[model samples]
Target: MSAAATDHEHALVYPDEPIYSRITAGKLAMWLFLLSDGFSFSGLLLSYGILRGSSQVWGCTTEAIAKTFGCIEEPALGINFTALLTFLLICSSVTMVLSHASMVEGDRKGALKWLGLTVAGGALFLVGQCWEYWGLFGLFGPHHGLIHEGLKFGATHYATTFYCVTGFHGLHVLTGVLYLSAVWIGTAMGKTDANTLEVAGLFWHFVDLVWILVFTFIYLIPN
Candidate 1:
């Protein structure tokens, strides 16, 4: 065979690496994890929607005496408070991206600064969530004046789905915060690379994205 023909055959048999070869294995693994996690979150939120739709009433109103009059025949999940939590989470995503950017720029201090802010944002979000859950379930002490008595867990499908969905998301936020913290510590100790930071950022961003969906479907939607 001619040299040109042999070379052509070799080229065809040994193609270049796939496009995804540009992505580090760690990054690729993170994407795969996020994709599967996304499906789980989607299933939970879809189930919430179905349950809410089937229910005749899905909300409650409080009387002046701090008692729940009963389910309000509509969907309401404390939009104002949850909206604030959503905002915090979105802002954390911004910080996460900034942290990655700083790492790429070889500014370890800047990266640490942004990562610290991101962790704080996640921690704040968890605090707000715990407060919300406490109010709903009266877990720690006497029921707060702001929450109605009828809003305990297992009271209705609304309560069940609300806690299950938001509680799941809250767990993710907590995990992300702890994960970011570990990354930050590793970076500080010079044990972590930019790729590791980027991978952590991917998880943080996914957590934020899922919260936006949860906030919209669970908190903002009306029956």
Candidate 2:
């Protein structure tokens, strides 16, 4: 047999690395990417915390935040809409994980179903954020120090810090939703199989982790 023929036969018999090994390479790359992205998010959150903690005016306790926002509209600890938003985001994370699992299990239909539910939850979360923005901008009064639109709010520092931090986080969430939408489209096109699902799942999980921190620091944490 010719040398070239033997080489060709070897290539055909020993098809490169197995799919599982290739999947591992993809997973490693994803983890590295996520690690860098995680650092970026951590920096943002840390900056927010440092600035927020330094602000004497925003030092109001959770009770004060609720009062200022008219959370209860009466007395009591009041039902904070931010808390509800947190819940929706957390629930969406669960649905996203389920979607990933369905895809891995070769249940494309199940994955689609869960993906739709996740998208709905993400929509609700975005709407809740809009309302929160309105509450801070409108009811809080530009002067109260949440929206520094035109120096109308007395403390530009406070409003600027609050808006910038929360708005940045919101944008991240929006981006994550878009990423999920793309994954869903790819799955629909039969372009994304189990391996693709795993990579996308990692991204989704990272988003959820960031949101958990944001919810705790921005809303649940007192002052």
Clashes of each: 0, 2
Candidate 1 lDDT by residue in tens digits, 1-223? 9999998874453223487556776788999999999999999988988888886555653342124444433224567877898889889999999999999999999999999999999999987887765554655466342235445667667777877888888889999999999999998998876788999999999999998888888777765
Kindly report which residue stretches of model 1 are placed more than 4 angstroms away from their true locations once superposed.
1-16, 62-76, 135-148
- Which pairs clash (backbone N, Cα, C closer than 3 Å) in model 1? none
How far out, in Å, is residue 139 in model 2? 15
Question: Pick by TM-score: which candidate is best?
Answer: 1
lDDT at 198, model 1:
95
